[model samples]
Target: MKPHQQGTERVITSLDWLAVLPVGLLLRQVDLTGCGPTCITVSRWRPGAGAGGLEGTGLCVCKEDGAVCGSDGRSYRSVCALHLRSWVSLQSGGERIRKAHDGECKLAPVIVVSPKKIHNVTGAQVYLSCEVKAVPTPVITWRKVSESPKGVKLLEELPGDRVNMAVQVRGGPSKHEGTGWVLINPLMKEDEGVYQCHATNMAGEAHADGSITVTEQNKSKKASLLAWDNPS
Candidate 1:
C-alpha cells in the first residue's frame, strides 16, 4: 500500500493493480486503481500465486539492471532486486541485507602452510611444501633463489635444469585453495639453498621462502659413528 524508499529508489508495495497489467509491460504514473495516479513498472510476470508468483498477491519483479554483492555474501541481479529481497527478509523476521560491493567477491592468495627449513644429508630425499588459499584458483610456482658469481640475486623456476629436483602442484585440501611441493631425490650440496613458493591470481599474489641444508654423506656417517661410540 505504501512505497518503500531506499536511497533515491522507491519500491511500490501494492500489487493489486499489477494483476491486470500484461506481463513485461512498463507503465509510468498510469492510474489503474481508484486510489490515485502512481508510477509503477512491472518488468515481467511469472505464473503462480505466492511470494514469487504473479497472482494478485504476488511480489513485484524488478528488471535486470546489474549484478551486486550483498552483505550476506550472496550476489543479486541488481540493487532493486536486493532491496526487494531485503524487504522480504525483514518481513519474515530475518536480518536486513545491504549491498557489500558493486562486483562479485574476490580473495587474494593467503599462505596457510609455509615451507620450513630442512636439514638432510646428501643422497637423501627431501620435500618442501606450501599451501595457499585464494579466489579464482591461483597458480602455484616453485623457484630456487641463488646468488650469482657477481653477488646478484637470481631466481630460477623449479625443475628447470635440475635432474634430481621435481615440482608438483595440485588442487586443494579445501575450496579455492591449492598445494605445491618441491621434491629433491638424491639430495646434493648444490640443492642446499633457498627455495620460494609463489601463488598468484587476478586478485593478488603471495610468496614464501624456505631453505635446505645438506651435509656430506661420509661426514654425516662419521659423525654418527663418533656419537654412537662416545654417547654422553
Candidate 2:
C-alpha cells in the first residue's frame, strides 16, 4: 500500500456557528476541520425551559469544503454538540413537529401539570400523583409557592426542606418505577406549589408541572383543640 498525500483544513468559523444557533442566540463562527459527511442536527435553549438536545431536531448533511455531499442535500453550518441542543428545541414546534424523516430526530412529549387548587384553614390528608411519562421516565420534586396557612401540616421530604423527596414505588424498576407519587399525612397551605416531574435522558430533558391544593381538615382541627389544655 502507498501513503496518501496531506491536504489543507480550515477552522470552523463563527459564521458557521451563526448558521446553526437557535433562532435567538447570536451566531458565532470559527474555522475548523470538518468530518467528511454527517447528518446535521439543530437544537435550542428556551429561557425558562428544560434541555432540548440536538438529536431531536433537524439534521443537515455537512461535508468538507470539497467533499461529495449527500443527496436530498440542504445547506448547513458547523455547530458544537452543546449549543446544538438549543438550536433543536426552538426548531421543534407545531409545524416542524409533524415532519418525520430518518435524518431528523423527534422530541418526547412535554407535560405541564397544574395540580388541583384547593384551600384549607384546618389540616387535611391528601394523595396526589405528579404528572407522568415513559421515555426518560420523569422524577418528582416538591416546592412551596405560597405561604403556609396556619394549622396546616405537610408531609414534606423533610421538615424545613422543600426538595429531594424520595420516589416512592409500588413495584421495582423491572415491574414499575419512577412514577411520581406523593403522600401528605396532613396537608396544609404550606404544601402548595408547582410539583414538577422532570424527565431526562441522552435524547433531551422535559418537565411535567402540577399544582397542589390543601383542603381543610375540620375533624382533625376539632380533635386537636379538644385535646389541648389551657395553661391559664
Structural similarity to truth (TM-score) of each candidate: 0.60, 0.32
Candidate 2 Cα deviation (angstroms), residue 125: 1.4
Once fitted onto the true fold, the runs of candidate 2 whose alpha carbons sit more than 4 angstroms away are 1-109, 112-114, 118-121, 145-178, 215-232
- What's model 1's lDDT at 24? 31
Model 1 misplaced stretches (Cα beyond 4 Å): 1-68, 71-104
Across 1-232, the per-residue lDDT of candidate 1 in tens digits comes to 6556543334445533333333333323223342121123343344343466432421233354456778887656565555646756788899998889885457789999999999999999999999999877889999999999999999998899889989999999997789999999989998999999999999899999999999999999999999999999
Clashes of each: 0, 31
At residue 177, give the lDDT of candidate 1: 87
lDDT of 2 by residue, 1-232 (tens): 2222222112233333434433322222222232212333333334444464222332233322221111223222232322233334446651211212223232343443434544444345554554433333434454333335785643333224433233453322331124455556556656656554455544465654456655356765776787785433
Query: In candidate 1, residue 116 scores what lDDT?
Result: 98
